[model samples]
Target: MSVRAQLFAASLSALSLLTATGALAQQGGLDPAKLGLNANENLRALAGSSNTAMVFDNRYEGIKGTPYAIPRWLPAKLALTSNIPVASVLLKYDVYKQRLLIRDPSRPDSLLLDANKVTGFALTDPSAPDVATGQPRVRQFRRFAEAPVATQKAEFVEVLYEGKYSLLRRYAKEMEKADYKGAYSTDQRFDELTDKSIYYLRSPEGAVAPVKLNLKALQAAAPSLAPALKAEGSKRPLKTAEDAASLLRAAEGQ
Candidate 1:
């Protein structure tokens, strides 16, 4: 196991003990001993791990919406750059900051995994099903060095429909600072995380471009696929991401 993997696995053993003293606790109550590592190495790895050291008091205190892709942490499968594979990782994606937050049972504060070292990651959303498949939605994300749209700000995008003409969901979030200007201001008092996701469509020639979740945008993204989009989209409402994915499938299949 790699150094990072060892640290992540060993943190669970320290989770309960740390929480007993109110030092730090894992994101979710996960069993660390299940990792089955040498006791001495576990301690060593725990000490070597980086604790965020940055804790916000009353985190998200009175915030209207969360700054995470998913408000709660989920088990994720991460693909690291150096062939390091860590399964069942308890982590959260902070879309606002584009940071990968990892939970360490041993630490007082959650650790932030270096997003740069992550080549790709997969998250499963229990509520949503795959657009093309009936199975649960496995939202996969990866960083593209060169993209059809501006990716400098947000590096990772959700792969929705991958085919000759692929569709991607670029998540964008902005913290709407609390606008409570004294007691008389009519503005909202709590901070909010606003979602402004941008969609992209990739051509067969391998050019990805931003496309809105509508027939017009899809057609504009690829003039050649306009007829197919019109015929298929008219049959269904482009109301959700799944609808858009279905439409993309039609265009690609035709």
Candidate 2:
């Protein structure tokens, strides 16, 4: 056979191997090592295994409603700190499940990083508009390893006001029955999205405690700033997370 024909046959065989093993299906076209995941060597190994459950799949087409934190998907940077070198990667966060997802160009399937493996992350999206003042809402989050609130598992908590006394917000999402039924069937089986938020206070004494959403409870939590909080509450009651954050800032003399 001619040399050119032999070369062509070898190329075809290599392509067939890649296709059968699914090696050419990676997304994002980046290596996990570049994403600061040396410690997760096991996870990378599992990606190549025949067992499919190890791979993270984001295509949920069932009755599950939207699973994103924001109405729109915003580009953000994720930071992870571990025995491996600290690395930052462009990723997305699903606020509903509180999971970090990434789409690697090298793989056709996306991967979900274990929350426990992440130290913290930040969103680069422009500040959201506040519901009350129509101003941009600026918030940052950190992994609260020892959160005293009902969210027993340590996760990201928004830092509302940071000072001698700090206020934080924990967001949660759940699914509920939709008010309207599916158009195709009479069975009222459709599901709707619902969210829940809880606020907490971290005092100088190192106590992280949950604060109720009422004026009375706010006052009880911070007796020293009761008067100031009450004054702010009179102007704008603590009916929303932004309101609570604003009140905390006022108490801090910001």
Candidate 3:
């Protein structure tokens, strides 16, 4: 057999093995506890795709911090370009590479999902608890065309407050390299991932412009809520993402 044909056959074989475990995945996503698949095998299958898999491995080996926005995998619902939505996937957003990572119960390596296939995704916040519901908060993100903004089309923008006037956030991560001057010197040993997010306000007509995290910019983008924002700012701080979302809720009389 030809080399190309052999490679194609190998890819198909690996994928078929993964499909064998699809029954477990259908029983409400790939639960961590029920995973019987091997981690190495899973990663090999994920990387088996030719020119279709999302980028793999960290650019910097042995880096101190992870490339993901949050290191932990959270339950996510994926909206695919094919219009078929996939749910119950444990996902991680790699802010550095601007790609999504999927977790397998038995695998140490995450499956780099093909970004071209996914239009957007919704992730339940693992860290933040909703004060109103006393449960974990959920955040939604959409890609370039779905959530048009003045940035890379492949980038995912967080819909912090979706309304007539919407609020969006784009995460930009920078790697702070190791600063080890000498063995005797007291300096850091590992590179860290740092956040430098950019915020935006979308007009009712869907025009998006970058804005500051402060109230003035937000209120300027949402003039109707200016008075309410001013009043609330006086009572407390309008300096946080929570504050901004709260004011937006207040503006809508929610």
Higher-scoring candidate on TM-score, 1 or 2? 1
Q: If candidate 2 were superposed on the true structure by all CA atoms, what would the RMSD be?
A: 19.8
Decreasing lDDT order of the candidates: 3, 1, 2
Q: Which stretches of candidate 2 lie over 4 Å from their true place?
A: 1-64, 83-90, 103-110, 127-138, 149-151, 177-187, 235-237
List the candidate numbers ranked by TM-score, top first.
1, 3, 2
Residue 144 in candidate 1, Cα distance off native in Å: 3.9
RMSD of each: 21.3, 19.8, 20.9
Worst 10 residues of 1 by lDDT: 21-30
Clashes of 2: 13
Enumerate clash totals for all models, in the order shown.
2, 13, 0
* 83-132 per-residue lDDT for model 1 (tens digits): 87676677888888889998865665788898988987898777777655
Q: Give the whole-model CA lDDT for all candidates, comma-separated.
A: 0.76, 0.66, 0.77
Instruction: Give the TM-score comparing model 1 with the true structure, all chains together.
Output: 0.67
Per-residue CA lDDT of candidate 3, range 35-133, in tens? Answer: 654646578566655666576534334466577766788999889989975557899989898888898878878888998888888889858988689
Number of clashing pairs, model 1? 2
